[model samples]
Target: MRAVIFGASGLLGRSVVCAFNDMAVTGTCFSRTAGGLVTVDATSADDIERLLSRDQPDVVVNCVGERRPEVWAETPAQARGRNVEAARLIAEGACRYGVRLLHISSDYVFDGKAAPYRPDSLPNPLNAYGRWKLLAEHAVRAACPDAAILRLPVLYGSAQFAAETNLTKIARQVSAGVPMEMDDVCVRYPTHADEAAEVCRRLAGALLRGQRQGAVAHWGAEQGLTKYQMAQLIARRFSLSAGHIRAGEADAASGDRPVDCRLDCHDLPAALGPLRRWLFHTEFPPVVEPWLLPARPVSS
Candidate 1:
């Protein structure tokens, strides 16, 4: 099926484009240039309509976000416009064009008080970012009854190494002997972007086959790991000193995140294993090695 992915320059968006190579994929990017891609003025509905008309895609997957939580806290207006309003316009356009929309949402839609939440579970977002995401979900539902909502956890992959991901950024900072403060109180499953993209591809196929329930599918590692726990795991894998990773809580003083928004995948075979394996490769990739400090000097 022909597909259009908004925010195609970002990590998840890029993966989605790569995953759908067999199909006619139109990846929209505003900040960076990629081969055979066009930029979209996301704030304008007319531009999006023009794009939809030109591409004639069967599915539209939106991965755009005003990503930084701290930025969302500081600029709620920008977050609402990008996260909520943009999705609304896209969903409306998808409805008008009689195409399906697969919007990427986050597990942060739930407040931290709960653990291992299913899609139907009530959402009580504690931070501005989560609130905006929840608002976008509602907007999509209101605009397009048959659109699919896929809520994912912290996504990381080798696709965008050094391009600022949860795994890459933390690895770089900690390996450099720069202390990294992570949230011990807030917990989530870290899923690979490649896996998320695969799910999107499969779901889009299902959509094309007339499987559109507007259902929300949750995909994440089954294990609930705190941010500090993830940091420590990455450090150990890199053989970096654990001292580089500090345990802290997520709050207004510390980036304003949820307390326990880990997701439940609802028995999908692809959902993270009963084995509870770490989402990343056990060995540090070569690109990450440069960020690591030289082995500590040994004293006799």
Candidate 2:
């Protein structure tokens, strides 16, 4: 089967591309084109239509979005275009072409007050980024009712840059022995991109088999951790000194982040076999090792 993956150059998108390696896959990126990724304007209807028609893909997976909440606050219009408009156009195109769509969403749709949110839980986004994602979800559902929406938590994996993902950013800081004041207030399920990608692959397979259409699912690591805890874990795995890392309150400048957005992924495993599990200590070291800064020499 043929598949089209939008934002294929991104952290999650890259893994999604690899997950569907068995299929005829066409990957598109707005910028940062590499690995033969086609650059296309996802917001443009003509661009979406042309690519859809040309590829005639059996499934369209949209991993496109403006992930940073700060960026959304800084440039609402641009973020909206990428996060909302792009999704709507892609879903509409998928519907028009009678193709299955798998849209990636975020756990940010729910407020942190609630623990372990379900797919059917009412979304009360606290920040601009979450708000836009929720809007995008609506757009996708409206245009393509059969679209499968998979909501994921904060993701980390092999990224082009350490700063591209939150966990990698912390890993970089830990590697450098840089003093960090990490937030201990908020709880996050730090899921790896590969894990999410595998879930997407299974969901796509299910959709191809004409099952779970119009299903909204949540997939995330069961382990809940704070940024401070993540830093400690990274340091432990790398044998780096976490002495410089100290637990602190959440940064106000980081925007209105949820206290706990841990998702209830029981439904996902129930619907699609067992969910992929990874031990943070075992799985993360190799992924972040390549991007780590060299240790500085100690003064005599």
TM-scores, in order shown? 0.88, 0.96
Clashing pairs in 2: none
Name model 1 segments beyond 4 Å from true: 159-163, 250-256, 267-278, 281-300
Which prediction has the highest lDDT against the true structure? 2
Worst 10 residues of 1 by lDDT: 268-277
lDDT of 2 by residue, 1-300 (tens): 999999998889899999999899999988897789999899899999999999999999999999875778788899989999999999999999999999999998998888879899999998888888999999999999999999999888887888898888888888888676888888888888998999999999999999989999999988888888888888887788999988988653355788888888888778888876976667777778888899899999
Q: After superposition, how far is residue 282 of candidate 1 from its true place, in Å?
A: 3.6
lDDT of 2 at 45: 98
lDDT of 1 at 276: 33
TM-score, candidate number 2: 0.96
Residue-wise lDDT of candidate 1 within 41-119, one digit each (tens)?
A: 6778998999999999988999988777666768778778989999999999999999888999998888766677888
RMSD of each: 3.4, 1.5
